[model samples]
Target: MAKPKSGAKKTTPAGKAGAKPAAKKDNTARLDLIKNASKRVAKATTKLVKAVPEAAKVAKAAVKKAALPEKAPEEKAPKAAAAKAPEEKAPKAAAAKAPAAKKAAAPPAKTATAAAKAPAAKAAGGKASGKAGGAASAPVVPAADRPRPRATKLPPPGEPLTKREMEQLLTAGEGRGVTGEGSLKGRLVLVNDMPNLVVVGRDKRELTFLLQGPDQEVLPAYVDHKVSVSGLIRKTTNHGGVVDVRKYSAKKPEAEVVEVAPAETEPRLRYLSPGEVSMVTAAGMGAGIKGFASIRGNLEMTGEEFVLVVSNGGTRQQVSFLIEGKAASKGLRKHVGHTLQLQGVVDKTSGWGGRISAETVEPRPSEARAVSRDEMELVHIEGEVPTSVDVKLNHGLTVRLPEQPGFTWAIEPTVAKRVGLREANFEPGPNGGPATREFFFTPRNPGTFEVEFFLAKALTPGQVDRSFKINVTVKP
Candidate 1:
């Protein structure tokens, strides 16, 4: 400390000992450039700690490449969950050799939420072993997206068997057998060269089958509804039978409006005349009636013949008789619905349309006459029709009928407006055995009117095979 004083005090102790060896020789190159910039920030934090676990193994190999379409149906798993195949190929060979620039630093919403939890943990935990952040991975199901097996064929061209297959069309003898566990109730057809699923029964019989398990999406929404199925029956082909469907129950009926009172616009029958009831059992069973007449109505009996319906206003007639005695057939069923007063005879020579032949049936006091005479013009009769007739004014009412070997009688010009036609013929018989027609009505205006007839096979009255009514009453 005393050597400086002589050099001009060596300028203050020789500038503090030559400024400590040149500021420690320039802070030794700024602490060796901050120790080589802290060794290049410790080699960029050790390459971001080795690229954040190689970007989480390239985001678990982009969620095992979005579960390689469900691991190619993992050979349909289940061999005891595919018993240890090299520990499930060690995390799919480390996620298929990860390194695609670690999926640009991973985390795209955690690789789409681990790509939807590896197909619901391979469908509720089964083919497990998939662990890059495992939640029981196992998805990779792409053999063009699974689900194809039931095939044997027959539903293309107006396709119906449940839109060409979904499991109900097992073709091998393509149906017409298997049926005997019984339970069908009707309707549901699809026929047109069936493939399987018919039902039509209610005695129409037709059973076909195959709509099992979940009833193939529930019995095709009841095709033509009215179902009632009830499983197991297989007869394949003795004309038909196949019902494997199980437990069914549908319905949809609603439409009725019948009201047949004295209304006759067709459907008003009284057939079976076997040659006019053997000519009324040889003219004696009908007691061979003839001239005098006085009928009235309401006495029914039909089967062994006794007729007499006679209503009016809305018209109705029916009067077949032969009342003999023993007190007139003892309690003649307490006179059915009394209102009688017959005293007949009018068998007008045959087919018995007026069939009177009575001889006493008294219960009168209900007489309400009103048919102003006009006398005959064509007044004949024949082959059935007499429950209580009594026509007159504008006469000319011959009827005759008798042909029926397939059919022919027509008259529905909007319901023969109370009889007006006037002429028609065809007698030929004795040789052909069954021929006879005549119809010639007249009464255009009277109180109790009616006059239908239908026996179809074209003449256009349609559908009523053998019906004939004549509820006559035309009087004044």
Candidate 2:
């Protein structure tokens, strides 16, 4: 080991060289750090420059999205073309999108907010694209200009109706008739002077149908003739279900034929008395002979049947009759309370007790007198009277004769008897009014009669009214 003096400087090759190298290393490190920092700043600035363009693109997209609503005008142009033809719709839609693409390329503003709104702008653009496509693809037609479907008529006879067609016919409103095909085997009868075809249904039900044609000439020839008719069933206001005949054909006659000797006979119409009609009705014998009968009675309805109550010698008997026509039914109901004379053939069957096939029904002759108000006043009767007065048999008439306050009146009994007056009453004068007399008399028979009233004397003097006469016509 070498001994070293005190306060001597120590020098080592490695140390000296190492110290310089360390200093150089430190400087190189600092330079490398500065270079790295500069590179980072340049990279950051480049990135910022690149991001500015991207943000501008995003802003352009956002602006385009904001302006999407403004493209409504372009969208509407396709509507006109769509109305003309559907094929031109695609070209119109493509034209609408070109403007949006051009607008998106030019950015409105370069900002962070624009970048943030990029996603929303893209979404809005997608929606606008879809709306534009939809508007162009579909064309709307005005409802008023569209052609309507034609109505279908009913099928002809022998052609079965479909389910849908039958439903339509059933749902048709009242007064509308549905046509049907069926066999109508019946006898022809005159109702209200109009020909009608009476038919018995398959269910053993009787139905009367009105016959109408060019002149109703088709039905009369078919009397007692079996027929097959195609008609329209309708419900009337008064008459029950009636069918209007449209077409009819006669059926083949019976095949059975037997030779028999001809016997001479004549149908004699015998007049039926009330007692004979009553006995026949009670016996329930079917229509045996053609008879003539006239009965005055009131009409009453029981269920679907109409009954005529005839009063003969204080005895009331019911006679039922089936109304065959609408006019007859309506007239019967109209004149229900009035006295009607029915002339018809009396028929008795097991089903119906007693019925009359009435050929004619009319109101009975009225035996009553109608006196006008002016005529009543001409007889010297005072006060307001009815416009028209009806004097019937067993009905009395009351007359009020007016007189002055100081006048005395006298009625002759002999004149009253001649006038068919049963009794007469005189009422005293009221306060501050003229005297009044009331006469009541029941007419014995139908004739014209006159009564005399004499003014005997007047206490007031100078009033000389001698006598007056009143004429009254009685009726039975």
Candidate 3:
């Protein structure tokens, strides 16, 4: 401010000192960045180019392999030997068709029961609209036609009824017509998706009911197939001190009979991982549901019972197969793992488990079928842990183990000599199946032990035998 000094003696002029040098430095930095960026781009381009050639080579090799024809049998001696065995001839087509014809002619009628009728709808005034009003109405069982002496009182409109009450109404002395009598009017949820419906009142208790008609019929229900039951609801206690119901009719009473075709005609199925629940959900939620077939995965037998895990095309699943049989046998251990075709009723069960009932089990295409850890894990844990395991082998063969930590079948044996220590040991299983051998070695002294077995000549590197690893410790 004193004189607004025009220039400093030791400083460069403002235009020449800072501006040009700063500009030069900026240009140099920009050039360096541009050079580095070009180098990176060029490196990436070179890698991509190299990868393309390698990928092309692989593709070409695959194409060439695909073009090659399958190798013919180097030795036709087996075919010639088979031709000599007249007994080895293929099964007759007529013999096969005969059994199939018999099966087709068989009628599955378990009993003589009339078709189911849908229950009546409730009017806005809190009264039952009654059973079907259109065609297919229940044959009129007039008051005079009913067993003599009609029911004392038609059940209430908004309350749940008991099993005894229902029985009383069903037996409500002949001539006591129950049509429009409102015998079933409440929420009826089946127990475990069971055919036996457990009527629930507004209070949410089990209401036992007598499903009386000319004959007894199995009612079909999916998990949570919620619908209003509007027939006579007789509330009373049974001998078991449980609320009983007498549902005269339902709005939808035709037990949904899902008929599946025989196993041979079964469809090819895509398997899914366990986490894929949406696939199964979509199947059940279909509006016009028909029967379902188990495709994709193997039908496994555990504890003597069979089950199928249905896999969708993706990594998820939509259903599972549940077979009705005696509780799994205690000695049960192993089963085949090839995909199987099964036929049964598709049902929705309580909780996470639901699906179809398999009446038939047919083998599908696969390399080998064996029980995997994933299959064993599906077993429902109850009671004490089992000491031994039994596995089902192909061709009606069965294997048994007397103790744990001994033979892991995969690598343990191949030839008869290797089936057991020095000799083959065999025992019959419960199901009239062949016996399997196991070798036991209880070390007499406590020490580090290394056990090794020769790899079977018949086993390939990719076969299951290569993956078996067994470790055990013994103390005396």
lDDT value, residue 22 of candidate 2: 35
The alpha-carbon lDDT assigned to residue 277 of candidate 3 equals 35
- How many clashes does the backbone of model 3 have? 42
Candidate 2 residues lying further than 4 Å off, grouped into runs, are: 1-270, 273-290, 311-319, 323-327, 350-353, 365-476
Instruction: Report the lDDT tens digits of candidate 2 across residue range 313-367.
Output: 0011122344333325655655543456777765544322345677888887632
Question: Where does candidate 1 have its weakest 10-residue lDDT segment?
Answer: 311-320
lDDT of 3 by residue, 237-286 (tens): 33111122233344544687899876686454433333333344343333
lDDT of 1 by residue, 315-359 (tens): 111123434433346455556545677664445233223455566
Query: What total of clashing residue pairs does each candidate reach?
Result: 33, 0, 42
TM-score, cand. 2: 0.19
lDDT of 1 at 357: 55
